[model samples]
Target: MSKEEQAMKGLWDMFKKRMWLDSFRMKESLMAYNPSEIHCIAYIGEDMDSNVTKLAESFDMTRGAISKLTKKLINKGLIESYQRADNKKEVYFKLTSQGKKIYNIHEDIHREFKDRDQPFFNQVTEEQLDVILDFANKYNTHLDAEIMKLGIKMRSDNL
Candidate 1:
């Protein structure tokens, strides 16, 4: 591979490793709820139209798996299922007060991580930050195409 390719691959690998390490630390701090559970809570809390299919697609998991997680969350008082008048056939989820609490905690964790990385970001010039954002958008577009090739539908709005 060319030097640029090698450097890009190395950076990607290191970024993924750093994410895993952060996830591990989060898992340690939030032992009451598993990572998957916290993720579901966050999703439901953020999305007003969160449903089983949406959650499954977002997480790249089976509907059954999403159902299990939702059930667990429901039982834990973190989320509640609701049926809209126009879409009574399809059930959606919303975070309860307890779920909101969990969501806030999860957000706080993310904020802490971002704050920890703030120094690196602060040192980057505006032009450099713009370049990074452009690269990220292009990379996301590429990955979205690859995912489509595999016949998988993931959320693109967030990207």
Candidate 2:
């Protein structure tokens, strides 16, 4: 293999492993739920007043599962649900005070890790950081477009 190919493979491997480890660490910190569920909680906590249906779609989960999870959160006093002003059938959810506290705890945990790593990254030159940031954004855009196309093709095939 070419040197470039080997470098790309090493980068991909490191990225994948880091993502897995991060997920595991996040879940360990949250204690009660897995990474995906905690992600849903964090997103909902931040979004404020998003409905179960919208969240389910965002997480690619079934409405029933979202409903169940919402109920669990409500029972834990982490979230509250109410009917939307425009539509009685639409239920909106927002984090309770306790939920916000938990969210803050999660945020602090992440900030601690980020701060710890910041000094290490500070050695990277400004030009290098700019190039890396630009390339990351470009790659994300390209990947998103390709994923959307694949999703559409898959849906058409299913039909």
Candidate 3:
């Protein structure tokens, strides 16, 4: 393979492995909540004014799937749905106390994962880090353009 092709394969391999690790870590750490449910809690906690459509769009999920997850969260007392008094038409989601606890824990889990990988990151010099960041930015922009070409509304750049 050419150097460019080799780099592409390496990036793809790392991306898949990273995804697998994240999913495995989340599943192992939180037995009670599925990955989608856990991510929903985090997103709702981060964006206080999250609605079904926003969640669906952000997650690349269908509105019905988001609705089902929201219902489950509500049943578990992890989230509560509310609407502004003036705007009864649009529904929003917020974390309950239990949900907040879960969100906090999730944040900690992220920190822990970062910490776990800190040794490797610490070994990299600032110049090396800068190169990695630049490459990542360029790749992400490339992906965004590809997504635009495909007419896929979900852009990684937006996230």
Model 2 over residues 44-121: C-alpha lDDT tens digits?
A: 877866898788777777788889888888888888898867899889988889888778877887887688678978
Clashing pairs in 2: none
Cα lDDT of candidate 1 equals 0.88
CA lDDT, every model vs. true structure: 0.88, 0.77, 0.90
Q: Pairing residues by index, what is the TM-score of model 3?
A: 0.81
Worst 10 residues of 1 by lDDT: 150-159
Error of 1 at 41 (Å): 0.4
User: Considering TM-score, where higher is better, how would the candidates rank from best to worst?
Assistant: 3, 1, 2
lDDT (C-alpha) at residue 71 in model 1: 94
Residues 1-159 of candidate 3 have per-residue lDDT tens digits of 999999989988988987788778777868889877899999999997999999989988788888998999999999999999988999999999999999998998899779878998899999998998999999899988987998768733355
Give each model a TM-score.
0.76, 0.73, 0.81
How many clashing pairs in candidate 3? 0
The predicted structure with the larger TM-score, 1 or 2, is 1
